[model samples]
Target: MIAILKTGGKQYIVKAGDVLKVEKIEGEPGALVKLDTVLMVSDGSNVQVGAPTVQGAFVEAEIIEQTRGEKVIAFKRRPRHDFKKKIGHRQHLTKIKIKDIKVS
Candidate 1:
């Protein structure tokens, strides 16, 4: 079975035993997090979609780790002006392992 869930203002499609990185969540490694915003679910042959979210449908996941993505560099330059600027950024992320999905 697979499910599409929302967390931290983002949506992700996940299945059991799948590990994915999402926006930072408040938890440590091995923490159990229940995702209640289930948008859709499929069970091999049948699919169910919600108007906004499926009631009583949830997905369980375990926090694997909290990390940061690769740094992105932003550079600006002007010809014959000697003006230049450089910046770098990295986004915080949390890795979670999907354990199960319950549909009701």
Candidate 2:
């Protein structure tokens, strides 16, 4: 079975045993997090979609690790004015492994 869930203002499609990186969650490694915003679910043969979210539907995940993504450089230049600026950023992220999805 697979489920589409929302967390940290983003949506993700996931299944049991899948590991994914999402916006950083506040917790230690091995922490168990329950995501209640399940948008849709499918059991191979049948599918259920929610108006906003499916009531009583949830996905359980375990925090695997916390990491940061590759740095992104932002550069700005004004050709004739001789003005230049450069900045870099790395986004913090959390890796979680989907343990189970319960649908009611």
Best by TM-score: 2
lDDT of 2 by residue, 6-91 (tens): 99899999999999999998999999999999999999999999999988899999999999999999999999999999999999
> For model 1, how does the per-residue alpha-carbon lDDT over 1-104 read when each residue is reduced to its tens digit?
99999998989999999999999989989999999999999998999999899889999999999999999999999999999999999999999999999997
**TM value for model 2:** 0.94
RMSD values, in order shown: 1.4, 1.0
Query: Candidate 1: where are CA atoms >4 Å away?
Result: none
Please estimate how well model 1 matches the true structure, expressed as its whole-model Cα lDDT: 0.95
Root mean square deviation (Cα) for candidate 2: 1.0
Least accurate stretch of 10 residues (summed lDDT) in model 2? 47-56
lDDT (0 to 1) per candidate:
0.95, 0.95
